[model samples]
Target: MTAPLHPGRFAGKVLVVTGAAQGIGRAVALQAAQEGGAVLLVDRADFLAEVVAEAGASAAGFQADLETYDGAEAAMRFAGERFGGVDILINNVGGAIRMRPFSAFEPEQIDAEIRRSLLPTLYGCHAVLPHLFARGGGTIVNVSSNATRGINRVPYSAAKGGINAITQSLAMELAERNIRVVATAPGGTEAPPRRVPRNAAGETEAEKCWMADVVRQVKQSSFMKRYGTIAEQVAPILFLASDDASYITGSVLPVAGGDLG
Candidate 1:
């Protein structure tokens, strides 16, 4: 569903949102556009066009892989050329690439997990920092996961822990320059089924049990004992990106229904 038109909380702003084809990224893009910002939605999926359309005339879409620095730089350039400069950047392009025990993961799988859950944020910040500095300052909201402390995805967890470190260090380093860096650690969120599954192959019973264990642990960890909604996840993210959170920086707000990681 489209977000309701707002009284311009982000009027005259140019925003870039990674992974904006679906889930929390899509929700943030829609809300940012609804609030009068010109939004640029980036993702590897062709369905990004749909989000652009849903976001109305104020939005554009770019298809790019954010896991690589080159891809991240290209996306940032696309935003710069189309929107002049990015006033806000939402780095929401990471997830657990697979569900399995750490001991069961091959070396390649461990590398993939870091690439999928960490590099996008790291490379995104690197690629966009110059533009933000040129503009005097901007807001960067990285989407991290509460799985930083969960099961069956230790590599993914470590990646998010790295994100927490990134948020804190960069915020301090950029404070004098007016750039604010913050993150949201979302608990398991309730959203539509993935159009493209992270792992599409059939799993063995053991693998299925492992994934179930992860889910069980997630629910058990949440104070609310339930997964959060897309809207619930987006609220804190957009707030952190907006003027209301102008005084806040270097913090990772947990939107995990009481699951603070």
Candidate 2:
């Protein structure tokens, strides 16, 4: 869907991507870089640096635990120091911290889920707003899930619902500044086995088993036989981050392969 039309759409721009160690984050960073944008990859003290190095001069990485104040600050500093400034911020750092029947989560578990899956995106946006405003304006792409449409994924649904709201509110708030804000709701995605390691933090065995099961569940939920690949999902993101999407904002462009349709 996001073909190379102009080829130089993002030339000279600087984009910061969180959760850049792997999966959707990694793919988005590479896609942006290939389109000519400088990339600042960020993650918790690990995956970031490796991806950045692979990006060469077109990219660099920031290692931090974004759930904390100091961690977010350090990442902001890293982006500024590496790229001179940030013109685009992709809030791609979030996941199903804990999945269960929406009615089953303990209050504490819900809180943790919100902090881990939703707050980091907010913090990243806050960290980059100054740079974006100073430069007149920029674009932001927040990756969410089809669960945001109130599907049955419980905690993930709630977290993504919040992301959807934030994307809308921020889009309007930044519209006058010429900063575009949008979110993607992906479902039935193939996601492809990532080139970047899973989570890159060496998730505990229990976590690994749970995540692996999720992949199975997602496939089973779909009517179609296969899941959408990362590249297909990445298409809308590329458009949202490029000049071609300048006239679009506050749109929850779904990449869910007809799952929510």
Candidate 3:
């Protein structure tokens, strides 16, 4: 569904969102456009043009890997050269590329996960802040996870915990610059889990039922006893990215459906 239109909140602003090709990233990017900002959408997804079409021309799509400085550099250049400068930087990239049993995690696996899940939050902030600060102020909203509350996903949880730290630290560092920094942590919701084709090729009904049971267990962790909506969670995110949240910073807003309680 499209966001409610608000022309003045982000009018004439240049915004950028990393990991914007799907899921929460797509929701955030599209909402940013609806609110009157021109958005630079970044991700490794090849079909970003479709994403732009979905979000519209106020949106420009770019494919930039988050693994290396070269990838990050290309993204920074795209924003400066094409959009002039960014006024809102949304750090919406981060995820578990692969899952592993907690007991079997290798140091290399943990390091790689950190680089993927935490580094983009770091690089996007560092890369985009100069443009924002140069304009004398801007907004940053980092997407984190409710996994940080407990019931860890091994390295993914550890990495997200680190992201929360970055969100807090950056908020403090940028406060004097008139920039607002905050984060949104979402709990397990109706959003489908990433599909693993090879593993599910011949799953049995009993096996699937067991998996469903596990998901219910995860959902019950929420105080509201339900999952959140893509649109519902995205509202708080857009708020933190808007002038409405002008006085908010260094805070981690939960879209976890009351899960932390």
lDDT by residue (205-248, candidate 1, tens digit) is 88889988988899999989988888888888888999889999
| TM-score, cand. 1 | 0.96
Q: Give residue 136's lDDT in candidate 2 (0 to 100).
A: 89
TM-score of each candidate structure, all chains considered together: 0.96, 0.84, 0.88
Candidate 3's residue-wise lDDT over 60-111, tens digit each? 9889887676787689779878888888888888766444445655687678
Name model 2 segments beyond 4 Å from true.
1-6, 149-152, 192-225
Q: What's the candidate order when arranged by decreasing TM-score?
A: 1, 3, 2
Q: lDDT values of the candidates?
A: 0.90, 0.76, 0.78
Model 2 alpha-carbon miss at residue 192, Å = 5.3
Residue pairs with clashing backbones, model 2: 187-256, 189-228, 190-227, 190-228
Q: Which scores better on lDDT, 1 or 3?
A: 1
Model 2, CA-based lDDT: 0.76
